[model samples]
Target: MAAVSVKASKGWQKPPTRLYEDNYGFGINFYQPMIDYLDAKEEKRAPKEYPHLPWSNERGLERYSSKKLVKAYSEKDLRRLVEARTKADHGAFTLTKPKTHLSLTETTSAVSAINRKGSTKEEVRVKKMSDDVFDDNMEQLASALRSAKAYAIGKSAKAIESHLLAESLRNLSSNTEVDIRSFQRRAEVSSHDSREHEWFMEQRKMKEEELEQLTQPLDQLKVELLGKQTSIEIEQLNSRVVEAETRLKTEVTRIKKKLHIQITELEMSLDVANKNNIELQKTIKKQSLTLTELQAHYDEVQRQLQVTLDQYGIAQRRLQSLTAEVEEIRGNYEQALRIKKSVEIQLEESVSRINELTVINVNLSSSKSKIEQELSVLASDYDEVTRELRVSDERFQRVQVELKHTVEVLHEEQERIVKIDAIKKSLEIEVKNLSVRLEEVEANAIVGGKRIISKLESRVSREVVSKTKISIPYSLKVSEEKYRHPPRWRNWSTC
Candidate 1:
């Protein structure tokens, strides 16, 4: 009858008091009206429904078997299952990363929470349920044990099992403080332990959360320590530093080598360039001197040409004077020619008387031949003398050959003497000019005399230079020996 009324309630709210008290494992909802009814049912002699349980679902028992957990699973087996699950859930946990340690702290904290004490006895008994509650776990555990022994008697095994179950559920439901009358009548449980366990569970949950919070500091400390620790970061940084140092060294060495090479090349290039500049300077100096010498020669030539032009003008005036003189001589020569012609006529008359004498001379030469025969007859008386004369004639011809040889020898000697005389004459002329020039140079070396000596020496040197070369006629053209015998100035050789 009690179970029937609970199933039929339309206004029964959920949680701590909705179906039966044991259902509070979902959460405890205390319903004051439902509590009054549950109190009423506690005094009844009938079976009742209890909703929440550790293993208590009608359909689940039929299908997946919550009953199997009750009948087949022991407390130790459940404990093992929970442990295994915890391990499996966190199998990948390692302390390498900071997150892993943090997660471990959380799990430890959760486990520590589960080990907490229950609530107080008086607290459990007086704890006001929600006005719309459905079920509670502590309520259900006390009820099931209360009816277990009673349902065991006077029934078939299957029926006894059902009754025992029903009665157990009924006891479990009444144990809740929502209705004190159900299992409190004759029960092994006390309200004190029940409430204490609840309070302990709550304290344990807070402790677990506190433990997790504590682990945060520890995790932070671990991360800080790792940062200070020696690892790949520092090693790689050192390697990079070493590599940079080596590269810098190599760069320095390369730059130094390049600089040295450049210095050597620059030095050599400068040396060559300096040498070429010096040679060019010397060549420029020599060319400049040659230009000055050429300029001086040109000036001398210009002066000589001017002097020759002046001399030619003077010669032209002299030629006019000589022409006038020759005209006066021509009048005298014509007068003398006319007088000679008169003398020639007197001579012709005298020569005609001489021509008759010349005819008498021709007759005398014819008689002279007969006289020569008489002379021959007379010479027979002097034959010895004629023979002597023939011998003297032969000797005279021999003397003529000797005289010709002597003349040829004399001519060769005369040529040699003439060459020597020519050389002497040229030397004497040059010496006379140079001696005059020297006396002028000595005077020029004196103070205030240099200008006058230079002028006079130059003029005299020019005259001597003109007289140095004697022009020979074409028929008398000789070898270079003539010029060779001429005196050369000391300055000409230097030139």
Candidate 2:
């Protein structure tokens, strides 16, 4: 049985070190106690100096044994030993030999029998000495028996513990294996999903780029249309301005020509009137002279003198009408000169107005150019803004898609987590059932006294259980953390 335990312990030692080193990469010191326990178990005999155990004295058991000062084992000591043995079975260190108690008891009993057989001559001294030695020996024997009983009890208890621990470890190992397989499956599915998501994102990006390429020419066309319309409007305005200028020039020239013709006509009529007045004056002068000569011959003929006086009066009336006509001609000439001067002033005013109109036209043209420039700038700005809006809209859509993807991923992870939780519950139920079975095994092991063989097996089982305790929850926590947060692409939604 001891050889089996040693072999089992040796076999168990390598796995934990390898498992921990490969999977967790923990330092070997973490399992140093187990290594030391295995080492102690493999030895054929106890070491002269045993390693410190909780039940042993700090100075060591060998010191007490060598000095013959070993005290009788007390109930408390036995209890402590039992507890320590229980701890040892659960991966703590313990050392014992099945022969020590028996050998010591036999030697003491044989020495007492030899002393009791001494002759009567030395009876008193021998009896006193033997009595003292015998009392000490008896005490030692009693202590050894009690220790043996305690060892047997502790051995039974340890066996039960080992059996229970082994059962629990077996269940835990099976459950952990299942969990690991499920986790690996989940990892594979998540990887496939991630790859699909990446491919979809690339496709979306490509489509967005294509849309931008197609829209470029359309935006350019819109800009060109706007420019053409503005140019057309500018040309129409320029044409209207040119037509108005020409009309004003034609009207000014026509008015100046009409004024010039009217002044010349008036001047010609004045000249003809002046010439008629000169001729009439000459005729009147000649008539006056004829009258004077007729007066001289009046004395010769009284009837002829009366005839001459009538003719003189008629000629004087004619002269008076001629003077009035000459004066009217002078007044009309003055009015014609006044009209000419007014027309000259009006022509000068029209010329100044034309110049102002030309300046206004130039200014209007400049303003039209400025307006065209502004319209071009506005069109460009509109195109830019539209392009930016389109890009933003595409980004928003992409973010929406990403958000949906993330949400779906989270949902799937949550479903998987729920499944994992269900598995965990089932494992817990199985563990409970195993614990019940272990308790039954413990009862049977105790009744049957088959505890000694289970020492190393218990240690190995407890170690396995401990490793599972550390590793499984950590993996679950990592998976949970990975799925808890959303993806990085969701940041674009804020934009």
The C-alpha TM-scores of every prediction are 0.16, 0.15
Instruction: Write one digit per residue (lDDT tens) for candidate 1, span 1-495.
Output: 012224435675763333533333222222333555566578563236643333333333333322223245765576457445434443422111222322232434454465433286533442222111212332232243334334433344445434433543443344233323322321223335777556645754674576456556544554454444323334543465466668878999999999999999999999999999999999999999999999999999999999999999999999999999999889767765664454445335434533543443344344433432332333222233233334433443443344345345435534544243344354345435544543443343232223333443564456454433422321133223224323221111221
Scored by CA lDDT, what does every candidate get?
A: 0.44, 0.45
The reply for model 2, stretches above 4 Å from the true place, is 1-312, 376-495
For candidate 2, write residues 1-495 as lDDT tens digits: 011222235546563322221221111223434557668778643355655433324223343232333247975576457545444443321212122322222333443454344465433432443333334433443454354445434243334334433533443344324323433343444356777556545644663475456445533543454345434534543465466568877988998899899889988988988898899889889988987878766655776667777888887888789788878878866765565455445435544644553454355345434432332223323333334334544644553454355345435534554243444444345435534543443343333222322432454456565755545654554344335423321332232
Query: In TM-score terms, which candidate is top?
Result: 1
Q: How accurate is candidate 1 locally (lDDT)?
A: 0.44
lDDT of 2: 0.45
Error of 2 at 26 (Å): 99
Question: How much is 33 displaced in model 1, in angstroms?
Answer: 99
